[model samples]
Target chain A: MPPRKPASKDPEPLPRSARKDLTRAKLLQAALTLMGEGRSFTSLGLREIAREAGLVPNAFYRHFRNTDELGLVLVEDVGITLRRLLREARKMDVAPRDMLRRSVSVYLEYVKLNRLQFLFISSERSGGSRILRLAIRNDVTHFTNEMAQDFRIRGLYAQLPTASLQMVCGMIVMTMLAAATDVLDLPPDQPLLEAEMSENFVQQLKIILFGATRLNDALTRS
Target chain B: MPPRKPASKDPEPLPRSARKDLTRAKLLQAALTLMGEGRSFTSLGLREIAREAGLVPNAFYRHFRNTDELGLVLVEDVGITLRRLLREARKMDVAPRDMLRRSVSVYLEYVKLNRLQFLFISSERSGGSRILRLAIRNDVTHFTNEMAQDFRIRGLYAQLPTASLQMVCGMIVMTMLAAATDVLDLPPDQPLLEAEMSENFVQQLKIILFGATRLNDALTRS
Candidate 1:
């Protein structure tokens, strides 16, 4: 989140793989930087991305075959970012009285910390190339499945059937993505509005969780 | 929904207002057509849209000052379509079993019926111009408020606080929009998949509804 650590600060020559990783990261950052500057992913050209990355155009081919290939890598990064957020949330104290609210706070912080990635996913998830949209959808499904798995592993909503639990997680993920959109668009330096949105977000997730429990109860009774 | 009824079938001279309305509709349709062809709203130019609408560039100004204004009008149309869906859902027999499923069915049908409009909003909502993004967000909020109001008027979720009720509706609206994106992307003639998606949709909405009730109980006890 803090600009990611540089691969190295010393002048000592790094391993070949390390250098490749750094250049790959640079190309990815170049793409995100362009998108951050109001360019849609589809509008980006490989030459410009390479130029932005301070590499020759030929360097672009060392990483991606085309812009769409680069776009897919960005989507993959979004997937990783999402999984990281989930991992962070999993680290929170589940016994806390307001764990949900705390989780929302943590999630918003991560969203802000990784604003460009969230913005990229939010915009592309519903609005861009078919390949990218489907890719984002697949990652979202993965996220929702991981969430459902977490709930089960924690014995939360354990009574719900697998199908119902997944549905509930899907709803939760939808709410989270919607909140991310809000987080990305949030006006800078507006704590009051930010708090209000966070509270609203927590309440929305509560509705899904409680609703899943209620459904499980009804199924058990019937 | 059935392509909208023709204003007249007669050979008589049309009223001036009627002609103006028809031309405006053409311009709106042209914009949608362009977006449906995978063009982002921000990328559309006045000349291209006018040409697409079979009008001179001058006629474009008669309907919209620029493409952004036209985009705003499209957002307005999306609002109307959403409200109409709500109205249709209201007419459903609430006492019947699985009313949520019925509503989702009707809603998905509407989404498919107005595929272009849904596609327009889905893309522009967060992906394009700031103006269009904000406009769509405003309409979505309006749709959420209207949903909350309808619940209140009908005595649904009668016990939840107004703020909580609105938040619940916001979740529900969020789910609906997410489902719309699914609906818009659904492959042609896959009834099995469509039904599966519809069932998933109903389950998601039910979770929110039941969740809201559970929260209301908790709040009351607290």
Candidate 2:
């Protein structure tokens, strides 16, 4: 058979740096796929991940020295994802007219949009992997701190002292994570269940905000 | 060597039903032990659990048809544990002074006493095994409902309607579960970190209670 001619529609090969980035992303996606399939983060093997990425075992080393490093990078990616979320939240109007419900809607949509990554973090955050658990915990604490900073910047809960505000933010963050478990586990196409869950989520956050507003006064009275 | 003889302090054998109960408990405990070791509930096997319990595989078959069945039983046990905790909380004085702190201290101590069980539930509640996840979720729902009932009986949050009261209890239960993750992971013998964590836990519960009290008014205005 004669040699096949190249298709004119084919684009030029990407540059070396860009191709490397593509391969790195492939490895990360492979890990997420495995985790999204319900495998614990601690149980993942490097060779298996490389195979899943359709690359040679040696290629895995080019992107990450080991699985733990890859795990850390995944967590770092989660940190960025959370920061981006906070940034989106900042863009929303701070006027408290049904703001909590709107934020919950946006956040739940985000959780569904990035379902696999959230699955990985939630499972590994408390799973058997000490390294992953601690890394995820660090990211959560950073997220909580940024939330407190956001509240300060927006002048919400202004009466709360810095420590008290931080504590309140921590509770809010915990509530968000807890709601995520339900959000991730929710069955598909069940609008009624989804509404009930969202309503519950909204009420929970409202309670926390109201609690923060009264805590300072209550402490003073005591 | 001379034939082995029963020790002088050895008591008579337990009845057959009691002996069966002992083996059943052992099998349940073996699952918790494996989960506490970082193995996902979905990854545990019947033979492996039986071996961990120092029992024959047949003994495991007598107790549970599969690992998932054993997992459901463990979830049921958690329900009983939660009920016992509520009973103890009920016994505490109904006065408002420092009650939240006292309840938190008792709950944290209870978590420490049942570290492996909490580890199993926390890890499996959102982990790979769908069956175990659902079962744990059910038990948690039961715990939340019972908490609401107790609140009604005790006249706490008396003005709130039943539906609102139940939602408040759900949020409280979620907070308790989140705190369990931290309490289970806490490093041993660190008084400072433990106190700090416990204080944060108290603040979170306080916020929830305060939020519950004012939620009705907030809703009416809206």
Q: Which candidate is the best by lDDT?
A: 1
Q: What tens digits encode model 1's per-residue C-alpha lDDT throughout A1-222?
A: 444556566565889999999998999999999888877676677899999999999999988998888899899988998888888778884666887887888888898999899989888887767798889999999999998999899887777889888888888788888898897788788999998999989988777878888888887887
Quote model 2's TM-score. Answer: 0.87
lDDT of 1 by residue, B1-222 (tens): 344556466555789999999989998888889888877676688999999999999999888888889888888888898888878777874658866676788888888999999888888787877888989999999988998998899888788889998998888887888888887778779999888888888888888878888877777788
- Residue ranges of candidate 2 with Cα displaced over 4 Å: A1-12, A15-17, A37-48, A56-62, A218-222, B1-20, B34-48, B55-59, B217-222
Q: What is candidate 2's lDDT per residue for A67-110, written digit by digit as tens? A: 98999999999999999999898889656787778899999999
Fraction of native A-B contacts kept, per candidate = 0.77, 0.69
Writing each residue's lDDT as its tens digit, candidate 2 over B1-222 gives 534654555465689899899989988888888877767666677899999999988888897888888888888888888888888888996778888888899899999888888888887777656777778888888888988998888877777888889989988887888889887777777889988889988988888888887876665666
Chain A TM-scores of all predicted models: 0.88, 0.90
Pairs of colliding residues, candidate 1: none
lDDT of each: 0.85, 0.84
Question: What value does DockQ give for candidate 1?
Answer: 0.57
Each model's DockQ? Answer: 0.57, 0.55
Considering every candidate listed, which one attains the maximal DockQ?
Answer: 1
